[model samples]
Target: MLEMYRSYLAACNERAWDTIAEFLHPSVLVNGIPRTREQYVDDIRKTIAVFPDYAWQLRHVVQQPPWLAVHLHATGTRHQDFLGAPGDLSPVETDEFAMYRIADGRIAELWGTADNARLRLSTHNETR
Candidate 1:
């Protein structure tokens, strides 16, 4: 499961849109909301559009059977305003944590959050 999770992240970093369905179930649940695999792909696409150079670097991971917990360092240069930060193409970085439930070797459910407040603070400070 750990290796598979890593591969999933790899595909995301590669912006492999066509391969996303291979890592996510057709009926995926994200943060308690039901979303189709295409919706998930759209969400990723929107984020990448805002942060053209976005990447998620794995900081930690733990796997317990069908559950996987991940900590990631997400970084990018903003192409548009985000988290109250000006869209001056400044660098932004944040920590993200997520727990995933895998079904049939693909992610079926995910609960995740990112440190947006910290990123906002850092960006605000930089503008000072």
Candidate 2:
């Protein structure tokens, strides 16, 4: 399961949407967002476009039967527009975590949250 998670992050950083598809269940739910495989691919593309060098640093991993939770620190620079926000050279870092539910050896669902305050501080120079 850790290997799968590592591969998933690699695929995400490399913007390999096709490769990412292999690790996800056909109907994967990310956070509260239910997405089809194509939708997932689209979201990944948009993310990579926004943060060209996005990378994740694994902090810890915990496993329970049928579930895996990962604590990660993600860092990147904005290089392209995203969700109407223009790119900036300022580096952004956020502590994020995700809990994945595995079914049949594939990721069936993910619930994730990130340090939005830190991200906004680093990127937009705003505090929340």
Candidate 3:
């Protein structure tokens, strides 16, 4: 299961948006919010657009039946404003923690947390 999860991350890095169904359930929820597969791909695209050269460095992975928790560090340079909403094109190194609930051998739900305020504050000076 861990290996599958890693492959999913690698696929995201490759921007293989079309292959997501191989890993995720159709009713997947991100942080408890319902998301369609298209929305998931869009979210991945946004992350890729903002951090074009980022790497998902894994810190730890622990798996118990039906659940996997991953601690990761997403470090990279920001190439553009993020979210197409509000963000800065400044360097960023954020720690992200995620938990996946697995069902029927696919990811059923995901709850992820990442630190963003530090990045925002780091770029605040540049924008000012």
Best by TM-score: 1
Q: What does candidate 2's lDDT look like per residue over 1-128, in tens digits?
A: 88888888888777788898888889989887888878888876776676778788889999995899999998888776544545666678888888999888788898988875564435557554
- Cα TM-score per model: 0.91, 0.84, 0.82
Ranking by TM-score: 1, 2, 3
Q: Which regions in candidate 2 have their CA more than 4 angstroms from the true location?
A: 81-86, 123-128
Candidate 3: tens digits of C-alpha lDDT, residues 70-104: 99887666776654424455666778999999888
Q: Cα RMSD to native, each candidate? A: 2.3, 2.8, 3.7
Worst window of 10 by summed lDDT in candidate 3: 119-128
lDDT of each: 0.87, 0.79, 0.76
Compute the lDDT of residue 72 as modeled in candidate 1: 99
Clashing pairs in 1: none
Error (Å) of candidate 3 at residue 13 is: 1.7
Ranking by lDDT: 1, 2, 3
lDDT of prediction 1:
0.87
Q: By TM-score, how accurate is candidate 3?
A: 0.82
